[model samples]
Target chain A: MKMSFEHRDGLGLLRVEEPRIDASVAIQFKDRFHDLTQNGTGDVILDLSQVDFLDSSGLGALVGARKLLGAGRVLELCGLTPTVDRVMVLTRMHTVFPIHPDLVTALATRAATS
Target chain B: MTGPGPIPGVIGPRPWGLTLRFAATPVAVRAALSAVDAGLADAGAPDDLRARAQIALAEACNNIVEHAYPRHPPPTEAHIRLDIAADLGGLQITLRDRGRAMPDGPLPGRELPPLDPGDIAGLPEGGFGWAILRDMTRAISLSRRNGQNILRFRLPHADKPGPLSRIVT
Candidate 1:
């Protein structure tokens, strides 16, 4: 899986272009997190529009990303499809991260607050 | 008079056309579910039924991968089978593995505890697979035979009247 990162106005938008994030790709998902956090830009917004499936391992990786962001840094998620959204809802992780409907809304909100 | 009787879980007089094999890794579990999904579709199951079946099967396969294979190196095999019935009502699935036997009591029920915002904020990282399977299917049975753990889940005929309906009508 490949993750593309774009930075605008101090918000890091990470887009994941993968169809499934189950056990088969959990390792790559973890590795991508490592690379994303290496730059120490903690204000992150993940765009999951392309991901259609996610299991526990995939959920764990997102939590791990939150931990890596440290205190006062925010990690939000955007563009969750219904299937992926259901997993987050079932696991109750939806509350842990702020979820936005789209990248434009996330960016716009961040801009308004900043 | 004819050879041995048909296998216990297998239906029909064709002498058990089903075949079961052990998939030794998590990768294999995913492959097994995909194969089963395709097979179910090819066998003329309706789209809604196939979707539910696929979701349930994926959850079960993930459980085996997470719980059964935890800490075990790759190649920890789980048994998988392809069961087909000429009569749609008798369709069944049998999944078995040599991992630690699941608790000998009844598995958890299907009702999901309501999700509170605070609880969601503190939600633990794992332990969601069983609930997913439970919610997606009507019945699940677990047993241990000869040191191998077996899990069987069945879906009733889509058009059949359920228990409550039968009682009312």
Candidate 2:
């Protein structure tokens, strides 16, 4: 449940360093994500390029993170692997979060709009 | 450390498959998934099929760990037995556990949570497991007998010809 954060050009970038976010670490992931983004503002992009597997519990944690961010801020996701993307699509969670192909596209798109 | 292999004590005609038994805990479930994936890869299953199978299996096993074996009471040393058999037609899976039966003697509804983009906070955080299992699997069935719960399902191979022979078409 390791996460690294950086503020890149007005966008908060959070990278999930773990390879898998399953039931074993879902709670830790939610609590840690809250601690890191509690004071942040604006849209925060989560980079999941390193994650290979995410079960339902992990998906719940992602939703929990979004709730923790509140209404004003947004929790966007980028770089979902094949398996992770399938889970999102199957569960219809893709409709809720603004997903991007990669971090570069997310940053560029958000920068252009802002 | 339990890995993917055949259990000799079990009496049955097993052609091509692997069996693994692990403690019903989150950490053990995670490890069991990896082992199952490795076994599938060794059996030459395609990536797409393996990915979907893994997701469905994870949800099923997690249910057993979270619901069947209660945490507050600190359940006894309950274990889950997973049996997977792969052939040209598809992959068959059977999970057995001595834990408590499913709620009300049936599986949960497969309906996904309704998402309202306007109200982000109103969205659901859970209740997606049954939907995933239903979408990714075929011919799912559950039975409880003699204090044992046995869940079975099948994951059909892709229509494309690959390691697993394409039976449909």
On DockQ, the leading prediction is 2
Instruction: Please estimate how well model 1 matches the true structure, expressed as its whole-model Cα lDDT.
Output: 0.65
Error of 1 at A88 (Å): 1.7
Tell me how each candidate scores on DockQ against the true complex. 0.20, 0.53
So what's the TM-score on candidate 1? 0.73
Error of 2 at B35 (Å): 0.4
Q: lDDT per residue, candidate 2, B81-110, as tens digits?
A: 999876555778999999988877556656
Query: Best by lDDT, which number?
Result: 2
lDDT of 1 at A57: 67
- Restricting to chain A, the TM-score for each candidate equals 0.92, 0.96
**TM-scores, each model vs. reference:** 0.73, 0.89
